[model samples]
Target chain A: MDAIIFLIFAAAAVIFGINVVLRTHPVSSALALIGVMASLAVIYLLLGAPFLAAVQVLVYAGAIMVLFLFVIMLLNAGSEKKSRGAWMARLAGVPLLVALLTILSFVIFRMYPRSVGVKFGSFAAGTVERVGSALFTTYLLPFEITSLLVLIAILGAVVLGYKELD
Target chain B: MPANFVPPSGVEYIRVLPEIILAAVATLIMVLEPLTPAPRKRALGYLALAGFAGALAGAAAAGWRTGPAFSGMLEVDGFATFFRLLVILAGLLVTLVSFPYLRREEAESGEYYALLLYSVAGQTIMVSAADLIVLFIGLEISSIASYVLAGYMRREKLANEAAAKYFLLGSFATAFLLYGIALIYGATGTTRLNGIAQVLSDPRMAPAGILTGTAVALMLVGFAFKISAAPFQVWAPDVYQGAPSPVAAFLAAGPKAAAFAVLLRVFMTAFAPLTGRWLAIMWSLSLLTMIVGNFAALLQTNIKRLLAYSSIAHAGYVLVAVTAHSEEGVQAAMFYLTVYVFMNIGAFAVVAYFSRKGERYVEIEDLAGLGVRQPVLAALFAVILLSLIGVPPTAGFLGKFYIFQAAVKADLLWLTVLGLLNSAVAAYYYLRLIVIMYMKEPGDSLLELPGMAVSTRAALWTSAAAVVVLGLFPALIR
Candidate 1:
């Protein structure tokens, strides 16, 4: 059952990810990206990382997608204009990409054989409790530093967005 | 919870005292900015300067006591203290330069100083980070603040363009870095530098493989981008040219040094065993960076762009030390960076002084007959420029000498020779500025240049004195 679910979500993710690049309009690309994120969330669930799946949906699909949509609307971007370089890129890009993909897959298979197949629930360490404990204990430094990062980001936004008062 | 989980000790707080002080002061500045009146904003600069002084003291105190903190996520060692002091000093100089410029532009606010402090704090974290995840967070914090600071003058179109270009390219580079970290974690099953080293050494745990090689390459690309090394330095000229001069000065000196610190630590400590694997790569990069940077700088008319290329070449020189892979090599690189901060920032301070309002006089020709109009400023600028060319009696000469000596000691004779040749080529451009300042006739409109502000003069003279002092006493940094 987990294998079937994983296959479906993985396929959806790949398709939507491709669409994200292929779409001409900014809004369509953003929507396609959201779809990709959602499908990846489902794949995370199949991998027994339910906490990760929920956070992926909430943070990535929900909050980040909204921000993307807002920016798209604010910019009022139309369909991307087709440039002359596209044909040149297409001629050289596809073959190179295919070669890279083939080499990567070959390496991956050689490194990790089918004996180590990953099945849902075969490794159940990704529970919320486990993650919380790890984050607050071993990863506490990074967890706190993340707040500082966010604070910097907020400060940056305000400095850039607002005008200087006379 | 584990049966015997031990919480971090109270000493961990003291271990990060400099960063803690920086962050607290930055937050205080942010909080006080809105409450204070506009005309009284210079007080904030003084306050920020006080904070930087305190942090510098804190860094000194922490430097005396070195160990891991926050469960080994960060380390307060000699390397970290050296860079933390360098960055704090740079921050202090930048704050001094910004006060007069901000008042002139009517952009004096607590937020500007706050962002500068925050960026310095971020850089401190970066040098001290012992874990890859912590490093990434630090990198993000610094990069974000820098992006905003680059565009601090929102009214200028060039500033906006600079901020956009820097943001896009910086984000791409960071993604590359994070992916590299992920791949390394995948290969070694660890994110801690020591843990990764242990795993690499343990044959039973993991084999030295292709994944690790790829990870190193990717991370090198990221570091190269940050330091503005050749082939990955496309964004720097434009960003530097477009940014406000003081901010550009800070970016060139502080962040570049911090990036070098992290690069040295990661490669030396975490990937020590992979030295043979990465040495050839560093050699080629060092050679290419020197060649491209010096040759490209030769054709630049704009002083800022020329300095940008020079900065890239400086990175190349540092890479030569990294290739040496010795303790003396690392020390040489640190010493070079210390001297570099003084000379480079001093040069930019002069540039900022001559830039006038809205940074109009940045072209090499714009400096014509400056020696006659303001002889002291022009003479000081000459000394700074001479130092940059690695002339005698200036810190740049000693810096280059030490780096080359380390390289020769490592038997990298060819790289040392090539680097010397690049420095020789670099002399032409630095000389051109001096000639323009002294020999050429003043332009018709250049007769009435503004008098130097006390703060600007103070910053310039301090850097100038430091250059000569450090040059004479190179052992001070050593």
Candidate 2:
């Protein structure tokens, strides 16, 4: 069942990644990026990183991506018009992406074998509770610092967006 | 999620006092900004400066405590303490420089001061971040505030362009960094720095999984962007040239310093096992940044653009020191940063001094006859220029001396020699301004210093004094 879920997430991640790159509108690209984030969260869930998956969805997909969209909308960035003058110049980025994907595939192959030798169940399942325990008990400073970060972001947005006093 | 959560054994408030103070003060300043009158807005700047000084004192008081704060996420030791001091100093210099610059230009200065304080608060948090998540948050806080600060003068088209470019690149970089963090988390099943360190150090932790070399390289790209190392340094010259001088100073000193502080902790403590891979990459980056930055500076006519490239070259020097990867190298990097704050701030102060009402340009030829008309200003300029060129009896020289020694001790002789050669090439540009100031005839419409330029002069003198004093006694800073 876990393997099936992982496979589904893997497929979605690939689709989302492609959409993020292929989309011409910055807003849609940003939305597709969030889709990529969500699928990545699902992958994390399969890896037994419940806390990380939740934070990934909340922070990356929820808060951070919202800011990206807000800024995109505020800026009102238009969809980039397809350029006709130099197809090769624009297509240069495609080859780079293709190379990256090829390298990624090689890495994935190294991580997995057609006939798997190791059992996935043998690994310890780190649940959300264990993560919270580690965070509060062992990593508490960073947690509070994260809150400080949120506070800083709020203050930063206010300072940037607030009207100047007359 | 809460069931298995066992909170770290002890929670300590003293460990995080400096950050708490900065955050509280930043909030206070932001809340009070609207209430402050336009004429008395200068007081807002003073208030922020006072808060920074007080926070520095608090950090000093909390220095060298050898325990983790809020679990093991924050290690409050001499290392963090040293960087906190450096960042606070960076904040102070920026405030001093901005006061004169903002008052003369802006119709509203309150939010400017408030944002400056908030950015400083973010930088403080960055230096003390102990986890990848905290580091990312601190990075965003600094980057976002800086984004606004870059385009603060929205009326100017160049400022708008600079802000736009900085925002686009910064957002892209943050995405890469966070993705890298997520990949590391997926592999180790934890985001805690020490946990990842432990997993990486473990010989049997499935290096084939998230421990792949690609993740490390991706993360390096993220940090390299922040530090303005070559190939990733495309944004520095444009952003530095277009942003307000004080904001540029803040970028050159504060945010960059915080990035290096975090880089030291992240790379040295968390990713020590992968040094064999990263060291080679850093070696190439240092060499490339040195060559490209210096060669580019030699061609620039605008003083600000020249300094921007020079700053990039300085980043190369810091990278070389970082490649040493020892405690002494860390110390040298911190010291270099401290000296850099003075030299770079002083250089910008000189530029601000020459800026006229409604005039932002600092052309190289404008310096002609400056040595004759304003002898004191000219003398100060000479001192700063020589220092920037790493001449003796100035902080810049000692900074280079220490960093080069650290690299040589690490047996990175080639890097040290390359650094020395870059310094030699850099002298041509630094000295060019001096030659124009002292040798050439004054143009008909030489830029005149405004009545309000006294504050800029004061800033210059203070920074020059720091360069000289620190050079005279390096132990004072250490």
Candidate 3:
């Protein structure tokens, strides 16, 4: 059952990721990217990384995607024009890409044979409760520091974006 | 493992007192900014100054007890305290320098002071962080605040360009650093410095050489960019050239110092076993940084860009000390940076004052015959320049002397020789400005530099006094 769900989300994620690249208009690409993110979050859940899945949906698919759209709108970016370029990329890109994938697969299979695999709850430690427990104890300093980082980001946006100050 | 989380004790809060004070004061200034009238905005600068002073006192108070805090994320040791105090002082001096510069630019606001305080707060965290995650967050805080501060004068085209380039390139380098940290954690099964050290020292559990080496190389790339070392130093000249003079000063002294502190702690502690592997790399990097920084600086016509390159060369000298990777090397690097903070800040403070309205007079030649117009200010500028040249009776000479001494003890004879020669070449550019200020004929553009304001004079005198006193006493930092 887990494998079936993983396959479905994994396929969806790949198709959406490819759509993101094919779409020229930035907003379209951004929306496709969100689809890719959402699918990936489901895959993370299937892999038993429940906390990571939630964060993927909340931070990446939600907050970060919104940020991407805001930037696209702010810049009023148009669809990318076909470049009078990439001759070398066109010539070597596909063959090099194939060779790269072959090498990567060879390395992965050599490291972990087909018999070596994960069970449904292999990463059971990644439950949201455990993550929350760790966030306040072992990771408390970094968690608190993250608030300061966000504050700085807000202050920077105001300093750069505001029209006038008395 | 315990099922329940352990709440932090009270001492942990005291360990981070300096950062807490700085952040609170900064947030306070932010609240007051909207309430205060326009003419009273300088009062916010005074508030920021008080914040730095209070933070400095807090560092001293916190220094007496040294141990880990907050689950070993921060280590309140001698090294952390020293750098915390140094960065806060750098903030204090930069705030002093910014007072007149902002007023002259007609861009005075509480936000500037707030950002400076927050940036210093970030540096304090950076110097204390024992875990890579905390260090990375602290670095983000400092880098983000500095990026905004670099372009504070939103009206200036140069400031905007400075901020953009710094932001894009800085984020790229940070990604590289984060990858390196992840790789290190994968190899060692931990992000804590001493945990990594234990794993590295245990032969049975040792990480593969290739993995740790690659991680170190990536990290060095990030640190090199932060310190403006060679090959990754292309941004420094341009950013410094365009940034407001005071912000450039703060960037050169504060963030750069904290980055060096992180580099020293990580390399000297966690990666100590791999010294043989990285030592040769540090030697070459040091050589390259010195060669590039000094030779390129000779051609710069803009005074700010020249100092920017000069600072890069100084980073190379400190790198030589780090290449030694000995107790003496850390000591030498510490003393060298302490001296550098003052000398570099003093020089930039002079530039801030001399640049005048809208920063119109940044050319090296524009300093012609300043001795006739303002002898006192020119003399102070000369003192700062001479120290940068590593002349005797100035802190720069002692700093370089100690660094070379450490290099020799470590058998880095060749680097020592090449470094001495590089400093010789560096002297020519620093001297050129001093000579121009005292000898060359004053140009029409050399309108008698406006009477130095009290804040500007305070900035100049304090830094110069630090350079001179540290030069003579030597024991103060040692």
Better of 1 and 3 by lDDT: 3
TM-score of chain A of 3: 0.78
RMSD of each: 1.9, 3.7, 3.2
DockQ of each: 0.64, 0.40, 0.49
Q: By DockQ, who's the top model here?
A: 1
lDDT of 3 by residue, B1-478 (tens): 4566567788888899998999999999999989988999999999999999999999988887778899899999999999999999999999999999988888899999999999999999999999999999999999999999998887789999999999999999999899889888977989998898899889988876667777888898888899988989989998998899999999999999999999999999988988888988999999999999999999999999999999999999999999988999999999999999999899999899988898999999999989888899989999999999999999999999999999999998999999999999999999999889888888976765678889879989998999999999999878
User: Could you arrange the candidates by DockQ from highest to lowest?
Assistant: 1, 3, 2
Q: Residues B100-213, candidate 2: write the lDDT tens digits.
A: 777677645666766776677677767877778777877877788888888887777887899889999988988888878877876777777777888888988746643447
- Candidate 2 or 1, higher TM-score: 1
Shift of residue A51 alpha carbon in model 1, Å: 1.2
Return the top candidate by lDDT: 3
Model 1 regions more than 4 Å off: A85-103, B1-3
How much is the lDDT of residue B123 in candidate 3? 93
TM-scores for chain B, listed for all candidates: 0.98, 0.95, 0.98
Deviating ranges (above 4 Å) for candidate 2: A25-79, A84-92, A113-140, A151-166, B1-11, B64-66, B209-212, B444-448, B452-455
Clashing pairs for predicted structure model 3, backbone only: none
